[model samples]
Structure formats: structure tokens, C-alpha cells
Target: MRMPEAVTPAEWNKAHEELMAKEKELTRAQDRLAAERRRQPGVRIDAEHGFTGEGGRFSLVDLFEGRRQLIVYHFMFAPGSKRPCSGCSMFVDNLGDPAHLNARDTTLAVVSRAPYPEIAAVREQRGWTVPWYSSFGDGFNEEMGVTVDDNDSFGLSVFIRDDTSVYRTYFTRGRGVEKLGTNWSLLDLTPLGRQETWEDSPEGVPQESPYAWWRLRDEYGD
Candidate 1:
């Protein structure tokens, strides 16, 4: 084989641009992959998956709560654990009311392996009011592929259904983590918003909300 040619500065710039184009292309392709998965034939939940609901007992279908779309965020909160996954906590911190998603016929819920009693403690500590349910006696988390002992801590997954059928639309982890935040999505609008703090602005920076004003749910009123 012939020896590879050295990359001149000009050639390096060309290569960088080409690589960026391919990155954008790949992002689009991944989005298309999710779309195709959503289009797959829905799967019927024939086996009963148990859960402890506020109203005694409930099954997996009960989790759907009368909606065409369902998004179950598998929160890592096994029994006896003091805190859930920090990365998972970061994603949950970004979530807002499901009403907006509800308007589009989607229902969202956070499922955890912890018993409701333990799960409730954290919910109160975090001041989160999102609909949460316990899967203490069920294999729901394992069946969904989010149950990891110590290796694969947690993951974000989206599921959808129509009538009586359900299907897994998509799931992601690791560097795909950025997909969980709405703040970064907003920062991209301005010339200088991510605050890197050490960042220097040439023509000054945009003003509006002070970053310090943001607070965790538990400390919101304080």
C-alpha cells in the first residue's frame, strides 16, 4: 500500500469541515432512526407487570394512564438507596410539567425500583410533584433494559402506544446525555450565554435572567 500523505494546514481545514458535515449528517440519521422505530408495529403487553399505585394494585397498562403516547423515565432508585443517579437527577431537574406534552396526547411518568415509601421520601426532599410509581415487585425496569446493578447506572427511554399496544421508540445513554437539557438549547440562541464563567466576551454579553436565580426544586421558595 502507498504511504499516507501528510495533511497540510489547508488540507486540515478541509478535513475538519468534511468531518463536521458528516457529524451533522449522522445526527439527522439518528433522528430518522428514532422515527423509524416509532413507526414499528406496536407490541401488545400480554404479561402482567405489577406496580404499587396509590389505589392498591396496578399493571403495566395502567401506567399508560389513558394516552396515545407514554414516556417512562426509568429513574435509578432501588430500595435502601439514599440518592438516585446524579446524571439521572440532572435530567429530571430539566423536566417541566407534562401538561405541555399532554396537550399533544402524551403521558409521562418516572418509574423506579424503590418502594413507594422510599421513593416518596426523595420526591418530597426534591419537591418534585411529577407522577411517580413504584415497581418494587415487578421486572418492568429489567424488562425495559434500564435495570443495572452497578455497571450501567441509568438511562433515558421513550415508549409509545396506541389503544392496547405498546412499543419502545428509543433509548440513549452516555455522550448522548446532552439531549436531556432545555437550557443548553436556549443558550445556543445568543452569542454568549452558557456562562462558562471564565469565558471572556468581546462586545459584552446579553442580559435577562441572572444564572444565580435558578434553584433546585427543594430550594425554590427559599
Candidate 2:
């Protein structure tokens, strides 16, 4: 690897302080972005949508579980698939307990096109306590733009409920979902910073093939 130059403690502290200034600026910029996101207008969800969870059938509004806000993670698990998407699994592995989000009057859940039985199998195997539901036989996935041509795709959608009505506040897909994964945030703190081929790491820095390290939580070390 292209190692950093050997420096005295005083020089190292000086460099660290210089980087801290830019880091603080970046933090403020991120806060502004979040504020802007909250201000964006949303659309009313008037049509009914169905989902099957551990407790049987439910509507989209029911998924909110009486919370004012809901965040649904569209996991890419199509019908008849042997397993869930590795990427989605890895993303969910970093999810924290939901009580904190629930405390904020928000509910979080995952939805997939896979059958309830299949969804339950994986959830149990992974020991995930998060709520998950199946949208099979329902156009919810397609209507939400998370399914295309019989293929499932990843997405994160936010909704707000007012009285008896619900509205979609925001929807993000593809790389936009990265921010939800704490794994990436933790990696960003390391000198190698994800160590993916797309990263601008110094020459000779260790990097594995992209997605090579991905494995189901239970599949690793086996």
C-alpha cells in the first residue's frame, strides 16, 4: 500500500485539526439536505393496497400500526426464490432496534414479493425481530415502483398518516438506499473506506472484488 509519510505527533495533530474543519462543514451540509427532504411535497395514497404479515392480511395503512409515520424497506425477494437478496440481507443486518424509531411515532417494516411462508422462514433463520410482510398477489410492489417485469428491486419509502389517510412522503432506490445501512457508514470511518474497486483508495491498498464479501448473516463462516 502507499503508506502515509511518517510524521511527528505535532504534525499529525495539525493535519487532524485541518480535516476536522471540513468534516464539520460536511455535517452542516448533510443537516441542510435532511431539512430539505422533510420539506418536499408528497402525494396522497387513496387506493387500497394489501399485504400479508405474521398476523395475516393487512392493508397499507395497517402496516403503519397506528404510527404517524412509516418507513417501508422493499426487499428484493421474488416468489419461488430460495433466499433473499444478499445485498438486502446485509443492509438489514445493520438495522438497530425499532423501539427507538417507534418512540419517534414512526414504524418501520420490510416488504417483499415472496410468499409469507418463505418470508417467515428467512426471517426466523436470520433471527430478525423487525416486522416483515409479503405483497404477493398484490400490485403493491409494482405500484410502488419496486418491481419490474417479474423482477424485484430494492427501495426505501416513507409515508405519513393523517387521520384516516396516508401519503407517500419520499421514495428512494438504488444507491440512495446506501444511507440506511450502518455497515457503509462504519466503513467510511476506516482508512480504506469500503475497499471496493470503485473507491479512490491509494495504490496497493487492500480491496476485494465488489460484493465478494457479501453473505447471508447465517451463511458466513459456514
- Shift of residue 183 alpha carbon in model 1, Å: 12
Q: What tens digits encode model 2's per-residue C-alpha lDDT throughout 95-149?
A: 9766545544567799999999999999999999889999999898988898888
- Cα lDDT listed for each candidate: 0.62, 0.77
TM-scores of all predicted structures = 0.63, 0.79
Name the lDDT value of residue 68 in candidate 2. Answer: 73
TM-score of 2: 0.79
On residues 1-222, what C-alpha lDDT tens digit does candidate 1 reach at each position?
A: 898688999998999899999999987775444434434444455566888856666766677778555666777788788787787777778887555444334566788888998888788888877777898977777777777553234665555565666666556557655565454322222223333443333244323343543545345431
State which candidate has the highest lDDT: 2
lDDT of 1 at 168: 63
Q: Which stretches of candidate 1 lie over 4 Å from their true place?
A: 1-34, 41-43, 148-152, 181-222
